[model samples]
Target chain A: MKIAVDAAGGDFQPENPVKGAIQAVNENAHISVCLVGPEAPVRKELEGLDYPEDRLTVHDAPEIIGMDESPAQAVKTKTRSSIVVGLGMHQKGMVNGFVSAGNTGALMAASAFILGRLDGIIRPTIATFFPTIKGQGLMIDAGANLEVKPEMLFQFGIMGKIFASDIMGIETPRVGLLNVGEEKEKGSETLKKAHQLLEALPSFVGNIEGRDILAGNADVFVCDGITGNILLKFGESIPEALQTLLFAAMKKNQIDGEQKKLVGGLLKEAFAPFDYQAVGGVPFLGVNGISMVGHGGSSPEAIKNMIVNAARMAEIDINKKIITSIA
Target chain B: MKIAVDAAGGDFQPENPVKGAIQAVNENAHISVCLVGPEAPVRKELEGLDYPEDRLTVHDAPEIIGMDESPAQAVKTKTRSSIVVGLGMHQKGMVNGFVSAGNTGALMAASAFILGRLDGIIRPTIATFFPTIKGQGLMIDAGANLEVKPEMLFQFGIMGKIFASDIMGIETPRVGLLNVGEEKEKGSETLKKAHQLLEALPSFVGNIEGRDILAGNADVFVCDGITGNILLKFGESIPEALQTLLFAAMKKNQIDGEQKKLVGGLLKEAFAPFDYQAVGGVPFLGVNGISMVGHGGSSPEAIKNMIVNAARMAEIDINKKIITSIA
Candidate 1:
């Protein structure tokens, strides 16, 4: 399988992606990578990297889509940008999937516009992995569509269930509607309607509250992008705030350096799941082909994980399963 | 000053409320408490408590409202219930305010029905204090009204601003609309419209994301009850989950008992603000009279803090200020 990496994307530019692509190709003999970016800079960064030349190659695309540029406009105008060019390769079946650690909006726009939605899909959604006590769970529509109808939310549940069962390896993944209360009568009109529609699915688990997200009560949780994005960002901030507060308390308590280091190490181990770099990236599910987007501040390891995960997703033919399930 | 305590409310019932009331009267020489519950149980619980006899008295309320009962129906039928009778005292001007640790929905229902709303107020909102890096910030509409109009959200901002200024003591609290993004064009139609309405206020800050809640970017944040309640409950569960995870890690690492105790103490102190017992209860803003509601599992200390907070709110005439501000 071959995956295209957007070398010009992300805050770190060509270096992280180039190194990550080299690492990915070295780790997986069955997989090959195409580094998509400006030719000279991409080659310069890959010069000293040790890897099989046949597994790693460069695809030059001169234009760049900036991190802050309007997503739809950039995808429309910057046709030669790495994101556009890379996704174009996936659209033409040149690569099995495409991965970018760039602007989320731009990547989502380019993927939807170029690759289009899967057969029988209403709208393609973004699915992010949320680390939970029972391992990790998936939340769909994590900022793809801010305003979604009941039917769209139901589709997200189905798509999320497929991803969880296929990639995350959760058997009969419990799909839940993210609501304020556990009771069926609770939540807004939209959620109430969505709850009813979700009952038709075999894996549907009534309604799950916000606390249930991290508690691992459900394998798949679905919501509109507005609520999902807020929940995702809020969950991400907890570990950071806790670390600062714990460090300040330790300092005030006059803890010795050795003990402080021990405490810090323990905290890092305990909070590994909350780290964005560790989780890597979220996939744009329901698209025609495999498309993954990572954090803009992703490190080489994170980018490599995204590439490996994208390739795995492609190998499993997740889109084909989703189409069959929806049909 | 006088405050009515719902002695039959909360998980620990008459015990927590009765002890909290006695503590409140003893702590404040000028303040008096009316314990509202079944005459026998309330008097039994209050007996032997060293408090000024004249300052703490029991008001007989025979009926009780269960936590799981339908809120509006319970309030309407259970007229002699502690929540109903306690709120009735405020309605009749018999007490300056009412405090309960019972069912949140029932408390909200009784407060709205008996206390009524401030002039020009369309609905009452629940405002909870969230611990932030800067200090503590307030979030409004924390589950009072699930489905809210844009105008209601605008009102929440106004009411939250008043509470932050009068109670939290921020001179000019920055009121922000809780949204998906910092950009003005982002968020749902209701939030976008609410943003425009909030701009007329002097201290209105633009859109704030969920991460900003704990980061303390704004003194006051407003959102629909559905989102605010989810955020509040989700935030409440973090400390518990973190403790469980950290303890397991410590056990696996074979940390000694002494170090475990020391780490436990430090974590307790660091997470003190996240403890609902420390923060006491949230206030029902926009009501004609002061109404404070504690968590169902509230300790005696939490109930005491709620009583004190209610007294302080009544002393400042927060409702009167809200009336004038809105008009």
Candidate 2:
């Protein structure tokens, strides 16, 4: 299967995405990559890399969408950008899927406008992997629709459930609505209506609170994009905040550097399993085609994983499952 | 000023509340407390304590409201419950303030019903202490109003600012609208409107993302109840989650018990300064009277601090400042 990778994406640009695409093709015999970027830089980054020549190729798309540019404006103006061109390839069946670590807003905007929505999809959502104690949990609407209708959330549940089952390998994943309280009639009007609608699914768990996010209470947590985005960002900040507090305490207590190093090492070790970098990218589910967006600071390995995951998503034909489920 | 303590409130019950009132009066000579609960049990618990007899007294309030009871229903039925009776006393000018560690919803309902809202207050908000690296910040609408209008959030910012400046001891606290993005036109329609309204205040800081919460970017973080409630619950869950993950990692690495103990001790010390228990209770800002609610499992020390804080709130007359500012 063919998958297009945005080499002009992420903080590392062509280097990480270029190397990541090469690695994915080298590791997966069935997979071939079309790296979309400025040809000169892409080739220069690929100079020392050894790979299966026939399985990997480059597509020149000189324009770049910056991380700070207006998503809609950037997509409109930068038609030749890698994100635009890569997804265009997928839209026309030139590639089976497209992956990028570029601007999230631009990617989401471009994906919806270019590929259109899958059948029965009200609004496509950004689904993110939540690090939980027991295992990984998937949260949908991770900053797509700001204000969601009840039915929209119900659809998110379906999309999240399919993604979790097909891609993340959690069969019959328990879906929970993220709310203020655990009770059925909790939260805003939108959440209340969403709860009633989500009850149609046998795997639907009742409302889960913020405390449940990392407690492994639900496999798939559904919420409006605002809550999900805030939760995702808040979750990302915990390690740094804890470390700051920990260091202050260590200094005040006059603990020796050796002990501090030991504690620090232990912290890093514990956090390793739940690191965002290791997970690579998250999918903007409910889009017509497979489109994944990784972190801006994604490593080559993470980029590699994103490409492979994109291929796996296409192989499973997740959109068809989502369409059927939501229908 | 006279304050009433809920003897039937909190997990520790009459013991903690009884001793806490004694400690508050003992420590703060200007403050006096009336312990409110079932007369027999409260008086019996208060026996043998060497408190200033004139400064400390017990008031009869026989009915008990369970933590799990429906808040509005419980307030309507359990008229003589401590939360109800204590607020009633404040309403009747018998006490200057009331403090409880009982059901949050029940207290909010009863407080609003009994004491009423301050002049020009749109919706009374429950403002809780946000523990940041710099110090304690206050987040308003912490599960009081589920769906907030733009004007209501603007009022929350004003209430939060007054509470922070008067009670939290910050001068001109930086107030921010908690949102999904930092841009001016970001988030839902309500947030954008709220941002425009908040611009009237000189202390207003534009939209703050989820990452800014723990980093101490703003002293007064204002959002709708759902966001604030979720953020509060999520913050409360972090330490326990971290500990669980840390233990599993330690077991995996086979770290010695002694080192684990040392690391654990350091973690606890660091977390102590930011402990919610240490902060005691948070105020239901915009309420006509001073009303504070502590943690369910509040210690005697926490209860003492809550009572003292409640008295301080009365002394500062924070509601008057809120009314003045919002007007």
Top candidate, metric lDDT: 2
Q: Highest TM-score: which candidate?
A: 2
lDDT of 1 by residue, A1-327 (tens): 999999999999899999889889998999999999999999999887799999899999999999999999999999999999999999999999999999899999999999998988889999898878788899888888888888899999999998898888898899999888999889888989999999999999999987887788898989888778888888888888898889889989999688898888888888888888767778998889999999988898999999999998999898888988888
The digit string of per-residue lDDT tens for model 2 on A239-284 reads: 8888898888888989867888988888897677567877889999
Q: Model 1: runs farther than 4 Å from truth?
A: none
On DockQ, the leading prediction is 2
- Candidate 2 regions exceeding 4 Å error are none
- What is the TM-score (0 to 1) of candidate 2? 0.99
Local distance difference test values of all predictions, in order: 0.89, 0.90
How do all models score by TM-score?
0.98, 0.99
Would you list the clashing residue pairs of candidate 2?
none
